[model samples]
Target: MYKIISEETDKSGMKVLNIDKSDLIELMEDYKDRKYFLSSITGVDMKDHIDVIYHLHNFDKNDYICVKVSTTDEKVPSITKLWKAAIVDEREQYDLMGITFEGHDNLRRILLPDDWVGHPLRKDYDLNKVQYVSVDRDGNEHVSFDDKEGW
Candidate 1:
């Protein structure tokens, strides 16, 4: 159900498939019988759209495939049902890249605090606008809101 907009192999000999967002789950499910393991899920902010890449590997065949889906919308389908290992990766993407996983069971911040203002990993995030917690030598906890620029 997915169209391959582009397909190429990198220098490392990995097959990269650029597919539509709607066909991600279906394409993955089709290869489920072949025991393709979910290696990782990564998100990139491309200004106009966010790119979500799913890296899969077949240990038995020593083959690898990277599926890429570009979407302007923040929400995407969660493939946690197909691969249970995606729970953490998807949640981290939601937290950092501000992408929402519609069917995710626990789509909360895996790294940042719940009260954090913005997604730090996004290109638009302003470090100077952030307020973080600090501690004093007297063992006093304090919230510091400074004009600190970039990390």
Candidate 2:
């Protein structure tokens, strides 16, 4: 019971449906019951808002579809309950794009250190201020702006 804001076919001939954030969980649950597996989850910082995209595939039918939900608050429903693969996919999106997957069991940096500052994939991420990451003897990673401490 979700409304599709818009629908279009991408260059790859895959159907893409843009929907409201509130409809994501309900729609994905239906797709899961129909045997559609999650292919990936990614986010795009649209300057004004963020677009969280979910790619689903039905192997039995050899079909692919993408569900997109736009959020200015950078938050959306987590699909990890429906698809286990979404655990890592959502984490990557959260780490890189700063999109928070609400109801996620563990939403944290997957690629970057816990102390890493700023989401690098965002449109307004500062590139001039350099950050560094280093590992200690205990194998714990640390992020720092001071070059000497990081190195």
Candidate 3:
């Protein structure tokens, strides 16, 4: 339950939007309806969940808007309705982060295989490590990663 989206400049003097998931589509539509171009869509993981951010720019007005939607829900609503470029971005998030875009046209893995085990962008995730280990110094063992390899 985030509040209204802001269009003010931050410490860097660049306008940014602190958008909530619910208001994502509306914000995107506002820019698209004004003939803005889709700039980018990226994902950020907050340990507990993932957030997909969309950036749009209206060259004529020199204005840019950012829209963010969380992926904690069982299904995240798609913004492809407002910006077609969202399709690829959302797919990339889903593939690597396990985020699902419910209203997307083709919600499939974009970068990883369909059978990927877990979200890779999470802070707790280990890239090249897998399984448990016991340090001889303390003789205390713990399972850090799941059963994969090289852990």
Q: Per-residue lDDT of 1-151 in model 3, one digit per residue for the tens?
A: 3366555665656567777777666766666778998888777887677777777788998877666666666356777787778789888878776677778889987765444556777676777765444343555344344544324
Clashing pairs in 2: none
Candidate 2, residue 20: lDDT: 92
Maximum-TM-score candidate: 2
> Which has the greatest lDDT?
2
RMSD of each: 4.6, 1.1, 9.2
Model 2: runs farther than 4 Å from truth?
none
Higher-lDDT candidate of 1 and 2: 2
Question: Model 1, 43-134: lDDT tens per residue?
Answer: 99998899999999899998889999988997789999999889999988988999998899899887766656788889989977857655
User: 1-151 in candidate 2: lDDT tens per residue?
Assistant: 8889999999988999999998999999999999999998889889999988889999999999999899998889888899999999999999999999899999999998998999999889999999878899899999889989946
Query: Model 3 Cα displacement at 148 (Å)?
Result: 13
Candidate ranking under TM-score, highest first, comes to: 2, 1, 3
TM-score of each: 0.85, 0.96, 0.70
**Poorest stretch of ten by lDDT in candidate 1:** 142-151
